[model samples]
Structure formats: C-alpha cells, structure tokens
Target: MLIRDLPYADPGVPDVRSGRHFLLWLGRRQLRGQAKSLAWGTLHMASVASIPIAVGLAVQAVVDRSGGGLALAGALLALLGLGATVGDTMLHRTAVTNWITAAARVQQLLARRTAELGATLTQRVAAGEVVAVSTGDIEKIGWCVESVSRFSAALVVALSVCVGLVVYEPELGLLVAAGLLLLIAVVLPLLPRATRRADLQREKAGRATELAADTVAGLRVLRGIGGEELFLRRYRSASQEVRQAAVRTARMWALIEAVQVALPGLLLIAVVWHGTGLAMDGRITVGELTTVYGAVTFLLFPLRLVQEFAMAYSFSRPSAARAARVLGLRRSGDGAGVGDGAGGGEARSLENPAEGDLHDPAGGLLAPAGRLTAVVCGDPDEAGRLAARLGGHDPSAEEDPAEEEGERPDARERALPSVLLGGVPLDAVPLEKARAAVLVQDKDPVLLSGTLRELLDVPGSGRVSANEALAAAQCADVLDALAQGTPGLNGDPLEARITERGRSLSGGQRQRLALARSLVTDPPVLVLDEPTSAVDSHTEARIAGALRRVRAGRTTVVLASSPLLLDCADQVVLLQDGRVTAAGTHRGLLRDDPHYRAVVTRETDDELAEGTTHA
Candidate 1:
C-alpha cells in the first residue's frame, strides 16, 4: 500500500513495534521514487564495483613489473578513473531527485491535512509539533529517501569485492572478512542509543519552539502587563534545556563518528599485516597478495556507506513517528456515515438559544434566506466555538461512525450552539462547501499583506463586485484611505497596500476592512463575531445599521452583546449559562431581561470609565 494510505490505515494495534515500522512507513512512500532511481543506482554500483577489480589487476601488474603488464595496468587504471568519476556524478544526481520528490509529496500531504482540519487542528495538536513535522521532520524523511539506494548499492558492491578477493587469495580474504565483521558488530550496538538520544533532542526542540511561539503571539500582552521580562526568562530557560539536550545528543553521535573512523582504520591495518605475512610465507605470490590488499582497500569505502545508512536511519526515526502522530489525529465530532443531500432553502430549525428552547444537539437548521439573527453568549471562548461550528470548520461526516457515536456533545457545544444552514448539517459539511455557504468573520481576522483590491478578492462561486461589497460593509472611508494609490480607469478604490494583518491601519480601519472582505464573499450565511467590537460607538452604530441594510434578505448571525448591533437585529437570541434564556426584539429583551441590560449597560459603563480615564 501507498505511504499516504498507511497513515489512514487502522493503527488498531498498540505501537510496541520496533522503530523498523517507521522505516517501513517511509519506505512505502519512497518505493516508487526509489524504483525510478534504482536503475541508475545499479549502473552506478556496477561502475563502482569495476573500480576495485581494476585496481586489483593494476596492483598485480605492478608486482609483476613487465612491459606488457605495465601497459595493461595503465589501461586498467585509466578505465577505473573514468568509472569512478561517472559513477559518482550519476549517483549524486539520482539521489538528489529521490530526496526532492519524497519531500514534496510529504509536504503536499501535510498541506492537504491542514486544509482538512482547518481551525480545529490547533485544538487537537500542539502548534510546535506541527511545525516540527513540516520543517525538520520533512528534511529528515527526504534524507532517508536520498540515502536508501546508495546504501543498498554499496552493500552489494562491498560484498562483491570481498568475494573477488576470496577467489584471488583465500587466506588474506578470510582475514579481511573477519575484520569487516568486527567493524559491523561494534557499530551496530550504537544504533539504539544514538536513536534514543536523537528522539529526546527532537522532543525538547519542539517544546522550545512551542514556548517561543507562545511568546511571540502574546508579545503585545506581555509588554502591556510588564511581564515581558518574565516571558523572556522562561524562553531563555527553555532554550537552555534544548541546548543541553542537543549537547547530549551530539556526544552520542560523536562516539559513533569516532567508531566510524577508528574501526575502519584498524581493519585496514589488520588486513595489510595478515596479507604481508601470507606473502612472506610463500603461501601467496606477492602479486596475488597485492591484489588482495587493493580489493580490501577498495571495500572499505562501501563499508562506510553502510555505517552512514545506519546513522541516517537512527536520526530519521523520531521525525517519522512525530509525523505519524500528526496524521493519526482524527476530529472528535466527525460523523460515521456519508451525508447525501443537496444544499439550498431554509436552514434546518436549530435550537434557538435565545428563545429558551435548548434545541437538541443532534438537530440543526438550514439557514433561512435574508434575515438578521443575534447570538448571545457570556463567554468569548464559547462564542468562538459556536462560530467555528457554524462555519463548518470542524470535520467530515465520512469519518468513523463508532468514533462519532462514542462521544457526547460537551458543554462548550451546548453553551455556544451552532447556527446551521439548510438541511445539511453545518458541522458535518466539508470546509470548502461550508465556507462558500457561510463565512465567519472572526473578532481578530488576519488581513494578509496585499493591495486593498487584491485582499478583497474572497474565494467564492458567485460574482460579487468589490466596490458594492465595500459599500455594503460601510467602508467608504477605507476606499478613501486607499485613494492615496495611483488612479485607475473605472475608478478602482482598492489599490491601498495593506501591511501584514493590516497593522498599518488603526483598530477601527482594520475592522471595517475585514468586514468589507467578508462582505465580498457575500455568502448566504454570514456569522460576524463581534465585528464592531474595536470601533467607536458612532462607527459601531453606523456599521450595525449598514450591515442590516446590506444583508437585508440574507441570513446573518451576529455574536455580540453590543446594544447597537443587537438593536439592529431582526430577532435576538440571549444565551445564559449554556442555554437559551430569552429571545425577542432588542427592545423587548431590554424591557424583559435583566441579564441583557446588565451586559449591554455594563459595556456602556466601561466606555464611560475609559472616557473619564482619558480626561
């Protein structure tokens, strides 16, 4: 089976298997590429094998020291030189191809998996592990692919040289073979220890990456709270731990390297000593002994290849296991069976969280056409979770049925409750389909680096003009800001260069820009998670009114506690604790619900305090 298929296979059994399984996983992936390169590798090996035979013949000729022998030796040496040069060149080229292709495939698989998991991936796996899998682990896997054929070809060539020597002079041949075996036995024991050290080193490095990532993400907050020094100290400590683990790892590898050099040199010494004694004993001719010596010397190179293969495998094992773990992750809510349904029309009637009807978790509504809806949640995390669910950024319905049935909906799901679209469950629909039908503009949406026009190009099935979308989003000011760009025909207002995540823009400008981008998609269902949270009250009020007007007939869910946004909603849903506490118009909620007043009025109080502080 394919390596890609192996990851999806039932790892039904425990992972007590030796590290060989990891190699098998990588080998399965490398099989096709290796097969393509194997022919060139075989030819290269043939050329390499010829070198030792030619050298032995030349040595025999030199010992004979006749005119004809000298002439033949010259030809042999010339042929050996040509073979070595050609073989080395071909070997390098083929090996590099094998490396690049294997790495590309792994990268593609990883990218595909990330797209499949979407936002839910971070919840399932640590960010550092993912980084390790994509970068360092991928390079190691590539090295394994590039090294495989060379190792095999070298082994065969080395064995061939040994056999030729045995035929030329058995006594010396036997002595050299013994030395080679001793080298193998000594180095083989180091593999396990070296691999364990490598694994620990990689794990510590991953933790350090995680700590650094956390620090970078919260740098603003850390600086704000005067905890920058504390986080810096923590990061330094993490880095030190990684440094110590690396040093230990290097020590083990250094021992292996010492053996690689020393054992081979010792073997070469023993072979020469034993061969000289045979020559002196008259049991072997000087010419024959010389041939034996040349063969043993040539054979040492391939022996080193074997040692390298062992080292490479030892280093790559941990990376492969980490990659395996990442691929093994399955979403918690993926459904067991395939969902067969065409999308359109009113969304399934979901549990109205604001209507005091805690709708069944199993049920969902296909969203209706053109209506403003409000989602209320006390906890921000709960609101975000609900937003993710509604956007279909979760998992597929085709995942294992038993896995889906085994787990119950947690409090987070019940508390934040998804707003569905159509008969098809939003959570079960694939990301591509779900995203087209519904878009969730997160509280802090990332505005990638690009010109304003380029950034406004949202992925969608329908044609929506950028200007109309921006106008609908009440972003005329953003267009004016971008007017600083060179004028274009038809008067394009989207030429403004947005810095990474739009950091160049103020908080309000960024929010309006993000909202404008979301509006461009014009998805049938738009879920805005506190879109106006960062804007001033006046801009927030204007945006709220514009959004309702622009999305007049479209299904829209706004998750907010803002009085302005709530007042503009056609219907309001208030969630308390984890259930729907009340549902009605914004004014009705203000009159009937104390919790609604407390939240919205408290926000107003905070605004007044901010004004006082400024004064």
Candidate 2:
C-alpha cells in the first residue's frame, strides 16, 4: 500500500479478542506489504551471503594462478554487489512503508474510537496512559509489525548458509552449524529475564507519565494550596523509580547483548582456528578457509535481526493490550458503558429522538418535547449528574470490570442499560446518530483552540446560522475577545486564533463561545448544565430570553438555579436530594415550594443568619 492510501477506508474492526490477536490482525491487514518485505529481506540477505562465497572463489583462483577463474569471480562479485544494493534499498523502502502505513492505520482506528467514546474515554483510560498510547505505543506496534518479515528472512538465510557451508567443507561446516546452535541455546534462556526487566521498566515509565500528566492538569489547584512542591517531589520520586527500572532493564539487555556479541566472536574465532587446521591438513584449501571465515561474519547480521524481532515483540505486547482496552469500550446510556465497544454489525440509527419526552426514572425528571425545561438543584454537582443522564451516559460505569482490568471474560453477552429516546434505548443506537439526536453541554464546557469560524463548524440542522447562534448566546463581547491583537487572523474575529483550550478568553467569554458552539449544532434535544454560570446576571437574563425564543419548539433541558433562567423556562422542576420534589411554573414553584425558593434565592450569609434567629 502507498503512503497516500494510509488511514484505511475501513481500518477494519480489529480482532481485539486479545493483544496477541490484535497484533496478528495488524499483520494480516497488510499481508501484501509483509510479503514484499519478506521477499526483499530474503534477497538482501542472500546477496550478502553470496559475497563471502565469491571472496573464497577469488582466493582459490589466485592460489591456483587461474586468470579465467579470477575474472569470473570478479564479475560474479560485481553482480552480487548490484543485487545487494537493490535488495537492501528495496528492503528498507518496503519496511518503512509497512511501518508508516501500519502506524497510520492504528492512529486512525484510535481517533475513530476516541470520537466514538467521547468524554467517557478519558474517564476510563488514564490521561497518562492515553498519552503514552497515542505517542509512544503506536511506534512500538509498528516495530513489531515490521520485524516479523525481517526476522523470517534472517532465519531462512541463516539456515541456507549453514547448509551451504556444511556441503562446501564438511568439517568446517559442521563446526559452524554447531556454533550457531550453541548460540541459539545460549540466547534462548536469557530472553525471559530480559523481557521481565523490560516490562518492569515500561510499567514504571507509565506510572511516571501518569503522575506528570496529573500534576500538569491540576497545576492550578496544586499552586492554590502551595502543593506544587509536593507534586514536584512526587514526580521526582516517580521519575527516579523509572530511572532505576530503566537501569535494571539496561543491565539485563546488556548481558544479553554481550552474550550475543561474545558468543558470535567466539564462534568466528573457532571457525577460523578449525578451518586453518583443515587447510594445513589439505582437507580444505587456503581460499576455502577464507570463504568459511567470511560466511561466519555474514551470519552475525542475521543473528542480530533475530534479536531485534524478539525485542520488538516484547516492547509492543503491552501497548497492544492497552489499545485493545480502549477499543473495547461500548456505548451505554447508563453514564458509563460496558460491552464490546464496537457496535455489532451496523449500529441502529435514532428514528425519531424528538418525538418523545426524556425521563430519568431514578430522579423522576422529565424534559418534554418542543419545550424548555429548567431543573434546579441545591447542589451544583447534582445538576451536572442529572445532565449526564439526560444525555444517556453513566460516569459510574467507569467502575465496569472490563474497563478496570483491560479485559473481561464473558463481557460481550451482557445487555446494556440505556436511556430512552422516543421510547427507544439509546445504547442500541449508533454513537454518532445518538449524539446528533441529543447534545449535552456540560457546566464547564471546554473550548478548543481555533478560529471562531472553525469552532462553530459543527454538524447541525442548519436552521441556526453561526451569527444567529453567536448573537443568541450573547457572544458579541466574545468576538472582541477573539480579535484582540491576534496575529494571522486576516482582521476578522471569525479568523482569530485562540490559544489552546481558549485560555486567551475570559471565563465568561469562553463559556459564551462554548454555548454558541452548542447552539450552532442545533440538535433535536439539548441538555445544558449551568450554561451561563460564568456570565453576569444581565447577560444570563439576555441569554435565557434568547435561548427560549431560539429553541421555542425544540426540546431543551437547562440545569441551572438562576432565577432569571428558571423564570424563562416553560417548565421548572425543583430537584432535592437527587429526586424531583416539585415541578411547575417558576413563579408557582417560588410561591408554593419553600425548598425551591431557598435554592433559587441562594441566601446571603446575613439573611440566612436572620432566618435562623427567627426560627
């Protein structure tokens, strides 16, 4: 396959039956490339092997003072050099092609899975592990894939050379074959220890990566409490552990490498010593002895390739297992999903998501179709939780046995608990379809760094234009924020380049921009949690009015306690202790429900104290 054909049209659902299976599947996926690599590798090694034979022919020809034989040897040597050049060049080209293509396929599959899983992927897979997999693990997997052909070619050529030697000069050939076997016997036992050390080093390194990622993500919080030093100490400790583990692994591999080098050297020495005796005894000529020595040296390269294959496999096995874990996350409307992540066959589409009300059986909350519903909870966290459920997700599923352990026996047979959309289980529906049907905007939505136009470029019903959505979300000031001395923006706020995570914008601007992005999507159902928490009361009032007018006939669930927003809702529900205690018009709830009033008012300290004194 050409580099242009990378990221397969259908990276073909991997056989994640096991890590071993996944790697095998990668091999099978690029069978034609593998075969080409094998062919070229064999040719390359074969050409190199013939060089020693030609050298021996030349020596013998010169010893016999035969000009014709010498000329033939020179011609053959030139031909062998040409073959070697072509073979080696082609081998490297094919191997690199295989590496890049395989890596691209893997990266695409990962991106697809990430998009499929959405926010839940990070909850299940540690940030550090995800980073490691994306950055480092893919390369290891590519190495594993490319090594198979190289190793096979090396083995075949090594065996052929041994056979040729045995026939050419039986005594010397027998000695060479025995030495090769002895070398194998020596390296075989060292692999297990070396592999163990490598695994240990990998595990420590992963832990260090996780610690560093956590520290960076929470750097603000850590600094607020003067805990930066604490985390720094922790990171240093983890890093030192990684260093120690690496050193141990290095020593073990060093032992193996030394054995590889020393044993081969000993074998070369023994071959030369034995061949010299044969030459003296007239069993083999001086030129034949030279040929034997050269052949022994050629075997060294193939032998090293064998070790390379082993090292590649050992390093990639863990990475494959981690990748398998990520690919296995299934969609569940129950907060966190647990199943074979890939929807079996084609995932069913949502026929009519807006045709029915969204009901949360546990909390007795219902957001009706073609209307705006406001849910107020005393606890902000409770509102966030309700929002996740409304959109058909369960964060609690992070506790799933399959996710925790990376694999589970008999996980595929279990049925998924789902959120109902139009009286249909959302888990049974495809992720892309379900997401398009119901959009969930979290309380703290993140803004991706990009041009303002790029941010609003989302799949939507197209009923709401970007300018309209931005206006409705009260993002006029946000537009100014985007255009603030930004370089390469073409003097258009829409072309402004926001910093990563939109850090260049104020908290309120970022919130409004995120809200505008959500509004632009214009899904059939929208679950927005505290969409205006960062803005002032005036902006919040305006957004609440605009939201109601813009989404007049679309289902919108706003989980917020702001009185202005609640007053604008067609239906306001008061939730208490994780249950819907009351539901009615905002004014009616305020008049009749003391708990609702208390939550909505968000009493000042003095007012609460006066009320307590009166009580």
TM values, all candidates: 0.80, 0.86
| Residue ranges of candidate 1 with Cα displaced over 4 Å | 1-26, 126-131, 163-168, 217-227, 325-369, 395-420, 427-431, 460-465, 472-493, 575-582, 587-615
* Positional deviation of residue 133's Cα in model 2 after best superposition, in angstroms: 1.6
Candidate 2 lDDT score relative to the true structure? 0.82
Model 2 residue 181 CA deviation in Å: 2.7
How far off is residue 568 in model 1, in Å? Answer: 2.2
Question: For candidate 2, which ten residues in a row score worst on lDDT?
Answer: 338-347
Q: How many clashes in candidate 2?
A: 7
TM-score for candidate 2? 0.86
